[model samples]
Target: MSRFTTACIVGGLAAASAFASTPAQAGYYILRWDNTGICQVWSEAFTFKPIRWPSGYKIVSRPVPTFNEAVNLQVRLRRQGRCTL
Candidate 1:
């Protein structure tokens, strides 16, 4: 097969595996997009699945135990002028 075909297969597998994985933990995190300085509180089962494409967001805080905590963290980050949008 050509290189493009192989790459497509790998990306497809990564996306599928990312969806199929079981939950390892339940928590919230504050993610900031490096390109846009955008911050948001995300809630998802914690897993280390590989992404199928390039990513711009990174977690800025440890797994927060609750939604309230995550929101508080996001507020602080914004107040500090570190994250926005």
Candidate 2:
């Protein structure tokens, strides 16, 4: 094979790999503490895991795409008297 052919193959592979590898999720979750009934917007992408998280909190909403959206939902929940201080 010629040097030019090898370079083309290498470049193509690099581009393919770059496209195939996706970044981590940027979703957010809304959590409400059982003890306090206070809601919060969790920024971590992962869902509720008892082993990973402390007790007394439960996931109230599905994963939201942005932090602002999550906070809006939280505020709505509070207005409905679901999340109290």
Predicted structure with the largest lDDT when compared to the true one: 2
Candidate 2 per-residue C-alpha lDDT over 1-85 given as tens digits, one digit per residue, 9 for 90 to 100: 9999999999999999998897766888888888778888887755545442455788999988888899899999999998994
The TM-scores, one per candidate, come to: 0.57, 0.61
How far off is residue 34 in model 2, in Å?
A: 0.8
> What CA RMSD would you report for each candidate?
14.1, 4.0
Best-fitting candidate, scored by TM-score? 2
lDDT of 1 by residue, 11-70 (tens): 999999998896555789888877778788887764463342455777888988889999
Q: Which runs in model 1 stand beyond 4 Å of their true positions?
A: 1-25, 46-55
The regions of model 2 sitting more than 4 angstroms off are 1-24, 46-55
